[model samples]
Target: MDGTLIVGVDGSGAALRALDWAADEAVRGGFPLRIVHASGWEWYEGHEPSFGINRDVVRAQA
Candidate 1:
């Protein structure tokens, strides 16, 4: 089974803080971190989030 940490971000300082923490946790654990930004509904006529680029398993620190 695979583990993951999902964080929601919106280009704010607080969101960045959460992202930083999430990144650290992912580095501590052998799990993947998924950062998702609700790409705004205005441009949602037909848009799909990038699946392969930003999605990868991160190795824990040794």
Candidate 2:
């Protein structure tokens, strides 16, 4: 945890490219690579909660 490389992923093509670059940098720098997937939809007051919506589904989409 001393030297970690954090990469934000959103299940997008651009994110995949960044993840690849971060992985290589992590390896060369001898640091741990941490992948973080996040969503703000759950926190937005304007977001409507439907019957099928859940944290798992949101996380999977991230």
Candidate closest to the true structure, highest lDDT? 2
Question: RMSD in angstroms, candidate 2?
Answer: 3.9
- Candidate 2: residue 29 lDDT (0-100): 88
Which regions of candidate 2 deviate over 4 angstroms? 40-62
Give the lDDT of residue 12 in candidate 2: 81
Question: What is the clash count of model 2?
Answer: 0
Task: For candidate 1, write residues 1-62 as lDDT tens digits.
Answer: 35898998876889899999999988888679999874445544554565532334311210
lDDT of 2: 0.80
How well does candidate 1 score on lDDT at residue 23? 91
Candidate 1: clashing pairs of residues: none
Candidate 1 regions exceeding 4 Å error are 39-62
Q: After superposition, how far is residue 53 of candidate 2 from its true place, in Å?
A: 6.2
lDDT values of the candidates?
Answer: 0.70, 0.80
- Candidate 2's residue-wise lDDT over 1-62, tens digit each? 46789999876889889999999999988999999985565465665666546878665665
